[model samples]
Target chain A: MVREQEFLYASGRIRALETKLLSRTIVERILEAQDMDAVMRVLSETDYAPDFEELESIYDFEKALENSMKRTLGVIKESLKDQRVVRFFTLKYDYHNLKVVLKSRILGVEVPENLTTLGEVPVEELLKLSKGEKDVAVPKLMRLAFERAAEVYEETLDPQQVDLILDRALYEELNLLVQDIGHDFLKSYLAALVDLTNIKTMVRLKYMESDLRTLKKSLLPGGSIDLEFFEKMFQEPVPVLIEALAASNYSKVVKDGLENWVSSGSPAVYEKLVDDFLLGMLRKGLYKPFGLETVVGYLGARENELKILRVLMVGKINGISEDMIRERLRDVYA
Target chain B: MEVTLGQVLALLGAAMAVFLPGIGSAKGVGMVGEAAAGVVTEDPSKFSQTLILQALPGTQGIYGLLTGFVVMQRIGILGGNLLPLTTYQGLLVFAACLPIAIVGLLSAIAQARAAAAGVGIVAKRPEELAKGITYAAMVETYAVLALLASILMLFGLKLA
Candidate 1:
């Protein structure tokens, strides 16, 4: 608790940064922009405003967006006294990078160029570890994950198994880290993420008409909701899964998701609800002036923004309708 | 020259009045300084606004110093004119300094937290600096009351 108090300033500064985050209105303007020139004009109004000459492709703008998020995380990390809490949030990116590396290895292709520099492990080291190099150089938990994922992938010859193995491993790693710190907000946040991910997996698998066994295998462990619940819950259809979501802490959020799912027959609404729920929880953590919540919250918001920017930018470039692009955007941090 | 217990008690009271709240203010200001610097680091334009918020917790130290100065002068510690004191009279001054010593210490730290958060407000929303200042200033009420209680008691303590 005393250590949490040390972040009093850093958290406050984060709250300040939250206000500076591009608002829904700003995003709306970007969406409403007439053409690429108008999009550039809108970008000029934002923190993203820099040399327009450089952004020839939407991919460049996407890189710039990722860089901005990276910069923000770096600044927040620099300010924090104990960065371990923030480090846990960055672990998601590590897992993401892990997936990328593993997929690249499986496909016999080079690792994608858009690899984020956001995680604790360097890209070079992760890439090396993925190629079956030095066993001791990488973190033990990550090495364990890589080994598990590789074994599962080799045995099943299924890429999905690799994803599930790594996904479960990531949660286990996060659970260990969050529990060690014992920050109530972070613990709750991690639980929310797990539940949401679990729920999403259930929804997606059910939609694909997957068997209960496959569904159960996909569900990640280490969530606050008992593992027994998911074993039972995964047996039900997508609509029945809504009952579980309603029973859990996501009752309010699940209402809209379930309604949308019933009406549209799409999990898009449900997924968005979960995203908003997760983001809302993180944002609410900011009201308190101390602790790891703010640092983690900033990173979460940054990640969400990157996703939103990419979707909106790609949606615009692809000439996707405004309504479609708007539907695709997750809840904004600001 | 023999130093009496009565004079010693008076001196101890004065010393605490200076040190306790001073320490609190130092910590409070330091805490706010860290937050303010963080804000300024992100947005340099917010420096002035954050600077004002950073200064809020410092009042406790001033209040503490004021009480200590009064106690010192009354006891002739600072005036360079030593006043002979009985045990009971010294106890009165000691009891008088207690309000600021304890309350000032707690209040300053509490205020510092508010002030630090205020620095955040200025960082994110520079136009809302006044609201941030108001929030931080709200925490200063208890400190001010403690200072007042201390000063009034110090002034009321008439030593024969």
Candidate 2:
């Protein structure tokens, strides 16, 4: 049995670590850098220097930053002595790897050679799974997940459908485990994640004019909305769908996105709006009475920070002016 | 002389009164702490602001403890019993603990979540930290009110 006290102690260590997030001033400094070399000079003063030095191009720099993040995350996970929390994070990586593999197979794209491999199943195992000849050890370790995915794959008889099913199933299983921990902090974070993902998928489906069956298949099972209610709302026209969602916590920005999508016949802005809203929500929700949410919220903020950095760095390298980049930047809370 | 059951029940109510709010505050703090840690890992410079943001939901626990203390005082544990009470009278005091304890516990957790999200906002847009706090405090108001009512009831109760 995991000792709750140890978890709390580890959480204290995490608290100390949270004192290191980049400030707005730092972000601004990085934004003002004239080139990638200048950006690297600024980054060298911070903890993000490890992979920042390995890049030959803007694209390479972004990839390296992503790799560094994964590596740092791996190190942090190792430092955590609490097995359950470690397992929870590992499952997240596992899901992420699974998604990448499935996407590569379906799109017939080559798997990136430098893909981070921190999940228990390993990169080799994922590669084998992608080739449709699952290895015994990996599948055994992921038996329940593989079985569920296989069942969905068989029933749907469509690769895309199978992928969607697996995604939803993995999220449900992970969320159930989080709930069983009985930590109120984890519960709220998980709930918010589920809601965000469900809403994003709903909006995407609406944009695609997907059939009802496909839309239903895309929705995750354990969001704030009941399946029946979600299906009903999803069936409405796009404008009505926005109106229905406006009643929830995500109203302000999502409603704005819906209006934009209706007037312009483009969902791009709405997609960005959703991202901003979720990021904003996570940022605000994490700081109070600090615990697990703080850790997760910090991780999310770091991801956004990196995204912003990458955007700025690329814009600078491509000779895009600050004004253009600023105009294109989505509000963090929109 | 037999010690009345009313006194025993009142004692239990007082204990719950103190413990429940404590639980709520601990839970609330834990939620926000997790979020803060995650943000700090990526960018540690936002530490001061994040700490402030994460600490906001912890008031519920403090409020709960205060209510518990007030209840204890009213029952004469801290002073002389001013009135004689029947078993049903003690039950009313015990029942009063529920609204504050339950609401305090749940609302603190929820408010912490709102605060966690707010912290994320601050990390990205430091200018909007106040707005985020306002949103988080919106959830905290009900829990505070519940705690206040419980305290008021404990003081108003006339033990006879």
TM-score of each: 0.91, 0.60
| Tens digit per residue, CA lDDT, model 1, A1-334 | 3376677667766766777677888888889988878888887887777633457776577668766877787777777777777778688888888888888888888756557777778888888887778754678888888888888888888998888888888888888988888778888888888877776677667668788788777888777777677668766755676666676688876777766876888877778778888889888656656556667777788778777878788887888999988886898875
- Residues A1-334, model 2: lDDT tens digits: 3333333323433444444555566667777887767777888877677677676765677677667667656655654564454455557667667766665665678864435555666777777766767444564435556556656666765677656756776787777677666666566666767776776677678778787888777887666777776678776776786677777887876788778877877765666676676677666424443444444555666667666776677788788987766644544311
DockQ for every model, please: 0.50, 0.05
Q: Which ten residues in a row have the lowest lDDT in candidate 2 chain B?
A: B76-85
Error of 2 at A284 (Å): 6.0
RMSD of 1: 2.6
State the lDDT of candidate 2 residue by residue for B19-81, as single tens digits.
Answer: 777787787787677656655665677678778877887887787678777767777667755
TM-score of chain A of each: 0.91, 0.79
**In candidate 2, which residue ranges exceed 4 Å CA deviation?**
A1-8, A86-90, A102-114, A128-135, A139-158, A264-268, A284-290, A317-324, A327-334, B1-160
Q: How many Å off is the CA of A13 in candidate 2?
A: 3.5
Overall local distance difference test of candidate 1: 0.79
The TM-score obtained by model 2 is 0.60
